[model samples]
Each structure stands twice: as C-alpha cells, then as structure tokens.
Target chain A: MKHWKKILFWGLAISLGLVISLAPMPVKATSSNQKLFKIQASRFAFSPAVLAVNPGDQVTIELVSQDVVHGLSIDGYDLHLVADPGQTASMTFTAGQAGSYTLRCSETCGAMHPFMVGKLQVGGNDLLWRAAGLALLAVIAGVWWKRV
Target chain B: MFAPGESRLNLARLRVLDKLIKSRWPLLLARSITLAGFVFTILVGLLGSPVGSHNFAIIFVWIAWWTALKLFFIPLGGRSWCSVCPLPMPGEWLQNGSLLTKAQKSIGLGMRWPRRLRGNWLASGLFLLIGIFSALTLTDARLTAWILLGLLGTAMLLSLIFERRAFCSYVCPIGGFTGIYAKTAPLEVRVIDSDICKSHAEKTCYTHCPWGVYPLAMRDSSQCGLCMECLRVCTYDNISLNLRPFGSDLGQTNSITRLDETLLALVMLSSALSFSAVFIGPWGWLKSAAYDVGSTAWWAYTGAYLALSLLVLPGLYTLAVWWSQKTGQAKAPFKRLLADYSQALLPLGLFTWIAFTIDFAFPKFSYVLQVLSDPFGWGWNLVGTSGVSLPSALLGAAPVLQVGAVVVGLFWSANLSQRLVAKQVQPARARRAILPLAGFSLLFSLTMLLLLLG
Candidate 1:
C-alpha cells in the first residue's frame, strides 16, 4: 500500500468513527397527553415483554406484583418502582428516548431473576442505521486497502 | 505462511524475566496461590449464601476473574491463566508425584493418548455443553460449585487414566477456546534458534513439554500452554519467551488449518450471539425457556441453540468460503478452504467475547465488592464494605467501547483473510477471494453493533 493511501484510509476511518460516536441523539419531546399502562410482574417474567410507544408521550406505568415483591427498572430512563403483592406502584415520566432501552427486574426475586427482562421501544432508532453504515464502510475500506 | 510485518523480541535477554522462567519456584508459588484461591472459592460456593450477588464463589469466579481473563489476560499473554490454572494442578501433582520438583518416573498409567480422539473435537463438544447450561450455572451458587467439582473430578480421573496433562490437551473446555485465541496474543514461548533444537539429539524440551508440543516444530502459539517447562528443560537454553505484535500467529497456516478448530470458531461466534440474546436482550420468553431445564420450552430452546450453533452458522460460513473460492478460482479442496478461512473469525470471536464481557460484567462489578466484605452474605461486614453499592460509571462508555472493539476486530480479520487468500492464490485473485469472507466479517460486526448499541 502507498503511504498516502494508508494515511487517507486511516483518516477516513477515524472520521467515520468520530461521526458515529458524536452523533446527536434525538431526544423525546414532552407532551401534555398521557399514556397509561398497567403491568403485572410474576415469578419469572412480566405480563408484557415489550412496550412500544411514540416519542413525546408522557408515560405512566402502574406496576403490580402478581406473586412476590418485584421491582421494575429501565435503562436510559430514570424510572424505577417497587410493588408488593396485590399492590399497585405507579410512576409517571416522559418517554424521551428514541431507542430500545432494557427493562429489567431490579429486586432479586428467584433463581431466574437476572434473566427477567423486557424492552421499551420509544421511537424509530437511527443508531442501527449508523452502525450498519459503519460496517459497510469497513468492508469498502478493507477492499481498498487490499487493492492499494 | 506468516504475516508480512511480524517480528519477535526475545525476553530472555532481560535478566529478571530469564531468571524467573529458568527457576522453578516462581511458577510453583504462583500456582499454589491460585490453588488456594480455587479451594476457597469451592468452599464458599458449597457453604455460602445461595444469593448469586452476595456469594464470593459467584462474584469472584464469574464477575471478577471472568472479566480479567477476557479483557486483559488472553489478549496480552497467551495461555497465561492456564499456566496457573488450579484445575489441572492436583492431577499434575498426582501424575508426577511431586509438588515443586521434577518427576523421576511416571506415576500414572502413562498410556498413549488415542489417535482417533485427538485434536479439538472433544473440547469443542464439551464447550458447547457447558455453554448450553451456562444460564443455570452462572446464577446458582450450588450449581457453580458442582460444575467446578465436576471439572476437578474429570481432570483427576483423566490424569490417573492417561499421562502428562492429556486432559488439558484434549478435553478441557476452557483450554479449547484459550488455545484458539492464544494465537492472537502478543506473548509466545518459542525456540530462539530452530537449528539449535534440530541439531540437539536428546530433545530435552519435548520431554518437559506438559502440553505435548514440540518446540522445534512450533510455528505458532496455539498449542503451547506457556508453562515455561520447555524453558526450564532446554539444555542449550534455546527456548525464549518473545514479545510479538498482536495477531502475529493468525496468518501462520502451518498449524491452524483443521476441521475441528473451524467448527469451534463457528460455535464460539454463534454462542456469543445466543448468549447475548439470552442474557442481555429484552426478551422474557427466551430467558424463561433457558432457565427451565426440563420443560418443553427448554427442550425447544436447546434444539434452536444446537441448530443455530452447529448448522446455521457453519452453513453460512461454508457458503461464504465457497463464494470466495469461486471468485478466487482456487483449486484447494472445499474442506481446506473452510478450515483456512475460518481463521479469519478468531479476532472477531475474541473481541465479541470481550465486548460481551464488557456489557455483562461491568455493571455487575459492585457484587465483587459486596462479596468481599461479606463473602457468605452472613452479615459479617469483614471489610466494612457490606453496604457498598458502588454504581458503575461505565454504562455510558460501553456502547462506544463495544463498537470500537467490533470495528477493530473486523479490520483485523479482514487483513488476515487477505493474507490467507494471497497465500492460496494470486495477489489479484486474493483481493477478490478476501471479499466474501470480509463481507461475512463485516456482517458479523454489524450484528454485534446492533446487539450492543441498537
């Protein structure tokens, strides 16, 4: 490979990585209208494994434990609640994230407690597209380096 | 064939490192410390609290040690952990009838290892079996202890039945992947002068190689356990620990092409994907099925897991290799092509494991500290750290780290594929031959990125 080509190749790769790393994340806009969900937590799973909503929605989650004490915590969202058996624990927050965030069981319930998880899809996520584009760029870069 | 820019710097020229490798006491002392820790881990697992987070066995073994192994050891020092692994210590001592000295006579049956059961086939199968049950073992203290005990028992039985670390060479599951990834590590134990080894008639190095590797013929670091036995036994002082560039051994085709190792690579890649889905993905049904051992759902899950690992991933890889062969107009056999190209996945597999470990182990590191103060969760507060709940600040940087790892792995594998194809065909055809495998590697990277960031 030529020296200039190597420099160009690395420069492009670093730039692409930087663009992907520094890309501005789309924030979820707050709205006055509210969306309510009542979720039931059992021994090893939740009632609904996936919750999909549009951006800018004020989401209110009413969590009730069906068996023992369970806690619901969502990553990328500061939403956490603990509910005992037959009791409803509610939390209201704006769903402002435009990606998939993991909803996990916070409390140690049983043997399979660590595996108990759900998904919250806020809106159309662009991170996947950017990642796919970066991968494609890598292949092209590899081919170019080989030819040079 | 070797990489173009590869070079080795011998560490034997350094006085301290040479003395350390030449002497027997340092390695013995290190192994003894690890053995003590291993015994304590087993005891805690058997008698400690059932909670996975609060128990020293689960926290130390699964979180702390696992993280260090994946993140630092394998990449920096090939088979370094195996040098100090305590599982084979009892078996080795029993076989040699000594603790810190060289053996005068064989202690076990000393039967020849069967030729048919050689290679990595058994180790690959054992690795898959362990992976299938890892969901259960990683979370349950009792199960983890039993698994450790089972490994120790198997090692001892094999040592008594065979000779000279046969269990590690043929059947150990961790050894299977460690040997494969060790090729990419920066450290290697090799003959400083091959001519010296060839001219020497006695072949003293072969007699001391516990891993059954011949230093004279060693062109790669895959089979060497880095135990420094050859270093201690070399009469001419020909053995030297050399520092080389990472991925230096990946391009060496002399020792890397094998069907069993190819399958092991594919299995490791597929297993990483499946583990990520089961542990980190937001899917409750998959978790339930994996957790339920004997249920119909679990059976179905197992079926899917086997199909994906043994058939689907290998099938896709075969297709890619066939496409590359057709493009390159190579005359090599299909099996040869499959084996040769599979080496490209080593970097990606290793980095995927590292990325997965970063995601899985980092957030849970607080458990390590928690267990330190109360190893058995008996409210001991030994170190006044029982109430410590140090939240990980690494969550925000995890996605970037994962993406970087995947990208680096993709490029490294791509370079390796290019070199491998060039060795097999014309340089112009090599460019075309590398495309299919490079595409496959890129696709895998994209999939990993999706799993990590999307």
Candidate 2:
C-alpha cells in the first residue's frame, strides 16, 4: 500500500474505535411499579404506535379493534390475541425484557397488513448498544485481518 | 496477500456431481417440478381467497419461495436457481420446439436483439418499478398472479421474437439482481484449462450456451446461468463446475464493469433498507402511503423512494469514491474508479438482503404449513395442519443474526475494496484509496444496524 493510504486506513480505524468505546452509555431509568395502557388497532395502524415502560413493571394492556378484525402479536412476548370490531381484549403481564419488541398485526386485514407494525420499548434497551459495539469490533477485526 | 485462482475445487471430478451434471434427465426433472409449482401458484392466486395469509398463492410464493431464494439459494447455489427456474422453461421449450430432446434447429424468428437494450438497464428499471409496488404485489393475491402471468407471457413472447433466452439475459427483473449477486456465490462454471479451448476448432460450448456466455473466456459467474449446457457440449470435457471462495469475482480486476449493474447494486441495497422501514419499522403513515398507489401521499412516497435509490445512495457512493481518489493522489479516471469501487457493494448487498429475508420470513414460517392444508382458505384441512399456528421462536435471535450479517458483509466488502485499490495504485496509495471506501462500508453497515436493531 502507498504511504498516504496506509496512514489514512490506520487513522480512520483508530478514530472509529475510540468513538465507539468512548460513547456515552445509554440511560437506565429506575423501574416503575405499574402501568396501564390502551392500544387501538384500525384498518392498518395502531393508535399508540410506541409503548414504553420499565422492566419488571406490571403492565396491563387493553387492545381495541376500531374498523375491522385485527390481531396484535408482540415479539419476545407470548401475547397474541384477536379483537373483533368495536371489541376490547384485556391482557396483563410483567415486562421482563430490556429491549425493543415489534408489535405487528397478526391478522391479514388489508393490502398493507404485513406492514402494520408498532414498537414496544421496555427498560434500558441494552441490546442496541451491544449490537453497535459488536459492529465496530467486527469492522476493526476485518481491517486487521486484511493487513495481516 | 493471496492470489486469485488459488483455491477452486472442481465438481466434475466428483463422481456423483459429475454424473448429475452430465446427465440429461436430472435437470429436466427439476425444471418440470418447478414448472408444476409455478403453474400451481399462479392458479391458486387467480382462483383462491383474496386474503393473502390464508391463500397458497400468497403464502407459498411470498413466504416459502421468496425465503428459499434469498436465504438459501443465492447464498449457496448462486444462479443455480436459474437452472431450474420455470419462467424461461416455456420459452425455451417453444423456441427449441421440444420438451425433452435437443433440437437440431431452433424454431424462433431469430431476429437480432436491439443493440442498445443489451445491458441491464431495462431489468434495473423493471426491478425498481416492482420495488415501488411491492406493497401491493406482495399482499394482493390477484395482483401477484397477474405479475407472474405477465412475466411468463413476456418470456414466451420475447423468445418467439428473438433468439436464445432473451428474457433471462436482459429482461427479467429477478434475473438482474440474481445474476449480479451470483458473482459472489461460491459456485462457478469454468473451463479446466484454457489451452484446450484455444486450440479447439469448434466452439460447441459457446453455441449451446443459452445465456450467451462462452466458457473459454468466462472469468465471472454473473452471466453463466448454470444451465449445464456447456458441460454437455464440451466434447473435450474441458468445462467443470467448480466450488470456489465467495466474492472471488469481486476481488479480481479483470471483470468488466457496467454502470447499470452498479446502479442495480445500489438499488438493491436501498430497496432492502426501504423494505425494512416500510414493512418492519413502526411507521403507519409510510405503510399507508406505500399501499395507496394513486393517492397524493403515495406519489410523495414514490418520489422519496426514487430519490433515495437513484440519487441519494449513489451520490453518497460517488462522494466516497471522489474522496478516496483525492486523498490517495491517484490519477485513475473518475468513471473507471466509480465502476470498480461499486463492485465492492455486492457482498454487503447480498447479506443485507439475507438479513431482511430472515426478518420477514422467519416470523411467518408457520403460515406455510397452514396454507399447505388449506390452499384457498376454503376451510378444507387437506393435510390436517390448517389450524396450526406456531409462533416465531427465532425472534430473539433475529437481531443477532441481522447484526452478524451486516458486519460480515461490511468486512468482506472492505477487504475486497482494498484488494481492488491495490491492483490499481501503489501499496501506500492503495491504502489511502481503501480508507474512504472502508469508511463508506462501515457507515452503511452502521446505518443498517440502526435500522435492524434500533
């Protein structure tokens, strides 16, 4: 490799490493005791698209279908239920996972049924941070392997 | 440090693989089975319930076949799927005027294909158009049926008008990207020795290759459809199906580069990102905009989609290339550098597609079983699995898999970029040229990670 190319390669690699390692840690808030939320499902959307709660919180959800029959299925949780039009279904569970889980429509309601999605954010979401760190490590290791 | 052509394992030397490749019946049988499946999918889509999840047309085509092509086929077999793809079968049969036997003469009009339409521009444009309307095609059973029927009809028409496999070569949208990514696949069709090919009087392999690729001068896997035509026609037994390292073609400098293919690569990467956002992301308005085709919001969405795929992504890549050249003090032409560096995107593009596939397919895999029992959603339980609803247990591991995919793709691309630069400039200048390209790959990987994990 040419002199400038080698310098730029190592320089960028080190800078990337420092930036990732020195990045501020994600804020972890204290756990809340209890929370109750009502989520509404319509033709192809959820009213409360994002529901954020602390880990270990006792959460109660009232899901209502507005226009048609729709089902709510949340990833990382065994919560799958269908609600008919103008009907409300109730469920309660303790939020234990510290990550973001997708809440999607289980039933095929319309042409956009596959894309009807929401997010359930619980606690600190350490997984995202860990993933970022792993990605940086993988890049550094890859560059090093090429050099070797 | 390693040289090209260092590690290639010939499958022709293997007893069973050789037997299968040399035989006429195995490929025919595979193509026949897929043809039956293709007919079944189209029929069910046209005649079954409009509900996508309950219908076999939607479930089998979108969930099962799409997943298989992305997750397994392209990664392991390259354009091996094209060997058995049913789309070109009817056209080939009609053109040859034979079902199982090789014809002494083809039966087409033999009109020469338009010279300007020779590249992947049409395929890329068609692919972008399809991506623009994927919201409807993936969900509406009737629309899916129409698209499939349209592809089959076009293939037949083109075969009748022109000579060999024009649809597969430059018209099919699916073939466009598959051919590009197939270059990264470990499997390749190549000659055992170029010396024999050079001295041979008759070029039987070139004449028989349906995809218009000559095995003697074949340096890349992009054009070879793995149809096994060359293997049969090589009287000297010079052709061999080899298992090679992944991204081997991308690392070499001898391969021809085209702007359309490079744009296709960026389009694929952008499409993957856009698909994840529209389908998997928690965005309701985006979904509504995408689904409502003629609405004002849909037009806005389309504008944004085109801008992102055609302009923004390529603009960013151009900037990286410009920076690399400026910083490295290299004197290579701008267009040449642009094309060469664009090849580095293939690894990342393919793996990002796999990541997206894992996210989309792994969750709804049980639907495959449901549709198997009740194809038309008519309450018939033919296979006793109509009521089964197995949840996606792989959800927890999905993020990790996606991260691994993007990360692996980034590093592989970075390595290839470095190799590419080294071939053009001095060692130090090559390192400088590689830096910006590496940074670009890292940035793209980080963006993908954010989309996937965040």
Top model number, DockQ: 2
What's candidate 1's DockQ score? Answer: 0.47
lDDT of 2 by residue, B203-294 (tens): 89987788878887876788889988899889999888888888777866544557888888999989998888887777778888888889
Give the alpha carbon lDDT tens digit for every residue of B1-454 in model 1. 1324548788877889889988889999999999999889989999999988778998899889989989988989978999999999998898888987547975788887898998889999998897788778888898888989999999988888887888898999888888889999999887776888878988988877787789878777878889998888888877878888898877765534589889888888988888888887766688878888889988888899999889988888998999998999888787888988888899989988998988888667767888899998788889888777533233546655766677677777887888788888777687778888997888777777776655
Q: Cα miss at B428, model 2 (Å)? A: 2.3
Segments in model 1 whose C-alpha atoms lie over 4 Å from true places: A23-33, A50-57, A76-79, A94-100, A120-123, B1-6, B255-257
Instruction: For candidate 1, write residues A1-148 as lDDT tens digits.
Output: 4888878878977798778656786655645567888889996677787787777788888999999899998766666799999999999888874766667788878777766777677776565666676667666665566555
**Predictions: Cα RMSD each:** 2.8, 3.9
Which residue pairs overlap in candidate 2's backbone? A1-B427, A1-B428, A2-B427, A2-B428, A2-B429, A3-B428, A5-B431, A5-B432
Model 2, native contacts kept: 0.51
Deviation from native of the Cα of residue B122 in model 1, angstroms: 0.7
DockQ of 2: 0.50
lDDT accuracy of residue A37 in candidate 2: 82
lDDT of 1: 0.81
Model 2 regions lying over 4 Å from their true place: A1-29, B1-6
